[model samples]
Target: MSYDLLFTGGRVLDPGSGRDAVLDVAVSGGRIAAVAAGLPREAAREVVDVAGRLVTPGLVDLHTHVHPGATYWGIEPDPVAWCSGVTTWVDAGSAGAYALPALRRAIGGYQVRVPVLLNISAVGLTGRTGESRDLAHCDTDLAVATVAAHRDLVVGIKARIDAETVGPHGLEPLRRALAVARACELPLMVHIGAAPPTVGELLPLLRAGDVVTHCASGIALGRGGLDPALRRAYDAGVLFDLGHGSGGFAFDVLEAQLAAGMPPHTVSTDLHGRSLHGPVFDLPTTMAKLLAAGLTLAQVVAAATVAPARALALAAGTGTLAEGVPADLAVFAVEPGPFPVADVHGRRRTAPLRLRNEATYLAGRLLPPRLPAPPPPWIPLTAAQRTALAARDRRIRDLLTTPLVTPDDLADQFPRPPDR
Candidate 1:
């Protein structure tokens, strides 16, 4: 069959098939058709020679916030993720029952595949501290219905039950979220740290398919490192995610966790606009941090690609470079130097290595360069639309300015608002 593109002379590393060798890969119809030494380029349409770069399966970022208006925490998803060699990004609870439609609309027509985790809160993380604060917003029935409605895009359920975020109703909201997750037959991604319940209490509540994010965090009420309870959870097949967000990770905690043989199941940069420049720069930087923490090259790559896809239950070959798999690949350079990597705290550690993305390909197409463009002309709002928008804006403003009311009081005030 005629091919679309050929990538030649690169060191191919595919953990799925346990193959590592210098090979030429051929892409036909946007899928990998062959990987062998000295494959003839004569049958190909275009050839990209990457002699010295490391060619691996396209990276998968398991944790991110991609929803545009639903969550203002991060940069736009496609450019930030794809330019950095990430092809598939699992949006970590940026939308919930109410905002899923808008999130889908924002991302549906894009090339980059984004699987979203439905937040337990109906509104998702549209707030400064996140969306799990008001226990009344954690609607199990609505969350379950939303997941069922968008079964193709919604992969799992997410709940941030941190102390500062969840306030007093810590475990109660989590219990309700789990109930929703169970009803939908999907895994639950729990953001643990600085919470009311002890790690001991939290671990028992999770099952095999559940996920524990911020596993090495020092910010949680249980600032204690990865304890025996967490290990028990891991042993029981509960996945651990390295959600290295702006304020959740701690190098000390990570070191202790790694030392205790509790390696993270997936390595993800909880990247956002504020955290993009440092501490959690990007997916490659997060992987480099894991390497600096003593994981081997293969181990780090596996966590970033295969393991994350497995956790999300993406198609079998989606994150690997095996023949017949989609031709999504990343070319990277591993530079040797004393690279200073920091944790959530101001502490830093210098390691003798760093991985940087040299090039990225989605399917068989190279990503187009980002260009600056003029802003669009403002359109005049219709009288009816303007009035409705004004009313909605006022309601949101009032909700923000209102004093901290009980969940029951909030429920009474906003009784079963329609899903957005």
Candidate 2:
């Protein structure tokens, strides 16, 4: 049977299906038709020769903010996704009950698959922080109902259990989030940061399958050996996620956790407005950071793909290149170098390899290149960053204005009608 597209000459490394070799993946009708050593190129309508790149299932980032107009954290996902190789972008609580409809409207415009974690607070991230300060905003009943109605889009529940987010209301917000998650039969993803309700206080409350994002936060969990509280929670089957945001990831904290034999279950970039410009640029960079911290390429790939998909119990074959799965895939050149990677605390480490996305595909279609929008006004940037952005804009303008081909270089298809 003829195939829609054939991707050849790439090292296929889909950790989910234990596929790691040079394989040709064929796509037909937006699903994976075959993955084998040799797929006859003549049988395919289109062929993409990814000679020296790594081919894997599209990276599934479990934490992001894509609701552009509805929240301070939101960023447009398509532009970033096209270049970053992230196909399944899970917006980590950019919307609560009130703003979910707006988030849904925005999702309709994105080219990537967008799953969301509904915020426990009714007023979800409208402001920078303090969303759950007013205990009344943590409306469990409304949140549960919202999840039930939008189960197709929402995969889990999110709660920011921090001193700034919850104010005088200690762990009440998390408890309410748990209530909603329990009611909706969804996984609960809790963001950890500087705490009034300490890690020790909240770790016990989490059930198996609950996720602790920013698990390496220096501000919340500290920089020493793994705390017994964390150990207990981990042993009890609580998933630890590397939610590497602007203030969440610390190199030392991650290293210590790795030393303690507790590797992250899922690696995600909490890619929101503030963290988008620096620190947490995309999922690939975050994966590189994990590499610097101690995980292998396969380990991080599994964390970014299969592990996160499994954590949220995503669709049957959401993160694999197996036959019959959707043809959402990423191609990357794994450049080897002593790349200096840094954490939120300005600590640094040398990454042995970095992934540069060469092409991204979704549903057997190549994702077009999309330029990122300028940072929002409220997003603070250094003077150097501002100048760099200005230069980039000028470069794009220059490229667009310049002529592609001169009269002699162009083909005269109509033959000018004999100078009529």
Candidate 3:
């Protein structure tokens, strides 16, 4: 069959393909139709010869905040994540039952695909500290209904059991989230850095398919330094996700865990508005940090792509370059220099290898550069524009002042509509 596009001559590094040699990949109708040695250029209508670059399955960031306008921390349009070689992004608990429709609308028509983890809290991360502080917001029934409604987009459930967030009600919210996850047969993605219960107490609650993000972080409930609780959790088949956010990664703790044979099951950047600027710039930077933390290049790539997709139970070949898989790919270059990688704490490590994005493709289509927003005109604002701006400001203020869902309102919101 004739192909739509062909990529040739890059060092193919798909672990699933089991062929790291130079090969040509042909795409037909957005799927990878062929993978073979030296496919003729005449076989395709469009061809791009990528030589001397590392070509792998597109990077998948499993933890991020892309809920625009709903929360102060959400990142809009995800800042060209695909341009940084990320093709799939999973917004981790940014929008819960009440806010998901708006989040989906904001991301409509984007090239990159965004899956989400439904938060147990009905309001999701709508407030500055998240809704965890208010136990009333942890609505298991509402979370289940929301996930059931958006099964295609909601891959799992997220619960942040941090100390400052959950306080004394940590386990209650977590238990409610787990119930929803069990009912839906979906995995639970728990954020464990600080907490009311110890990591030991938390590990037992997690089952085989459950995931624990911020695995090696040195914060309160984290493993600290190769704690036995983490090893036990790993042995129990609980997946550990390297959610390297601004305050969730600890270099020393990561080193100790790796040394103690607790390797991460997946690598992801918990990219949000505050963390995206530096330290944890993007997925590529997170991979670089893992490389510096002693993971092999192959291991790092697998954690970012195949492993995450598997954890989320996406298509088997979704994160691989299997013959019939989609044509999503990322081309990168490993720069050799004194690359400085930092941790959540004010610690830094200078490593020699760093992954840098060269180009990104989604279903064989190169992503376009982001257009800059036009500057405001110097002339006095028109009356209509002023009125519109004022209306918008008022709407934002109203949204902020609106009372959030309480745990007591869970039953009303789920399996039944709220009272008018």
Candidate 4:
């Protein structure tokens, strides 16, 4: 049988099957037909020679906010997905029951695959602090109903257990969220930040499949390096996700965690409007950070592809490039140079190399990055849309007005850890 397309002379890496070799992969009718070292280029309608690049299963980002024109922090998924080698991205609590209709309407006709983690609060990340400030919004019944109604879209639940988001109520909202996750029999992606309940307190509640996002934030809430509770949770099968947002990732924290034998199970860029320009650029960047820290390139690729797929409980073939699977793949160029990497806290590190997405293929269709053009207007500008956009713009303006943080500002804003 003739193939539709063929990728030739590239190092093929499939973390799921531990298959790493220089091979030619063939695709037919949107599924991978064969993977071998030599397949006649004449057999395919198109043959792309990718000699110096690496070919792997399309990257799957387990955390992101892509409810474009809907959520305050949302960015369009396709552009980010295509430009960064991410074929699948999970919307990490950009919408809840009350706002999910708009998210569903906005994401229609997109080329990429986006699974969603329904927010526990009725009104998701609408405001700056996020959705759980008002205890009344943590309605398990409403979340359960929404999950049941949109079972195909809703894969899990998200609850931000941050000091400002949860406030005085502390772990009550989390309890409600846990109840909702249990009721739906879906996993929970809990965003842990500055604590009123603390990371230690939160770990006891998470079971095997539940995910702890932003585990590398260097906030002063959880006491000591690598909290014992977190270690115990890791041992108990709780998954750790690198939710590298504007304030989530810290190299110091990541190093400590890695030394503790708890490297992130899934690498995800908590990609949102505020972080798109800076430290948390994309999923590929996050994976590169891990590679620089210690993980082999293969291990980092596994975290981005198979590990995330398993965390989300996707079907068997979802994150593999084995024959008969969907032909979703990413081609990347590993450039050697002094690539500077930064964490959220202005801490810097230099990675000897960086991974750049050369091209992405979703079901055998190649997608390239859009050339620089004027920013497009957000579509379907309803009242809700305008409110969120205006708020975001105001924050952006404030960020611009605040002169670039000088040495004094950095010293004042991010205090050094007290002398032990």
For residues 80-99, what per-residue lDDT tens digits would candidate 3 score against the true structure? Answer: 56558888888899887889
TM-score of 2: 0.98
Q: Model 2 shows how many backbone clashes?
A: 0
291-402 in candidate 4: lDDT tens per residue?
7788888899999899999998876577789899889999999898577788888788877678898999999998765421112353233465457657767887798798
Best by TM-score: 2
Runs in model 1 deviating more than 4 A are: 221-224, 371-420
Clashing pairs in 2: none
Say which prediction, candidate 1 or candidate 4, comes out ahead on lDDT.
4
- lDDT on C-alpha atoms for all candidate structures: 0.79, 0.91, 0.80, 0.85
TM-score of candidate 4 against the unseen true structure? 0.87
lDDT computed for candidate 3: 0.80
Model 4: residues with Cα > 4 Å off, grouped in runs:
220-224, 371-420
lDDT of 1 by residue, 1-420 (tens): 667888899898888768788899899988999988988888889988989878889899888877544465635666555567888888888887888898899887666878889889887877656476777789888888888889999888898877776777758878988999889888899888764766777878999978888888887623458667888898999998899988777878888888888889999988764465455768888888888788888898899889988887886686798888888898887688788888878778776677778778888777664421111123233466458656766886797789877676765655887899
Q: What is the lDDT of residue 233 in candidate 4?
A: 94
Q: What is the lDDT of residue 324 in candidate 2?
A: 96
lDDT of 2 at 166: 94
Over 4 Å off in model 2, which ranges?
Answer: none
By lDDT: ranked, best first: 2, 4, 3, 1
lDDT head-to-head 2 vs 3, winner: 2
TM, every model? 0.85, 0.98, 0.86, 0.87
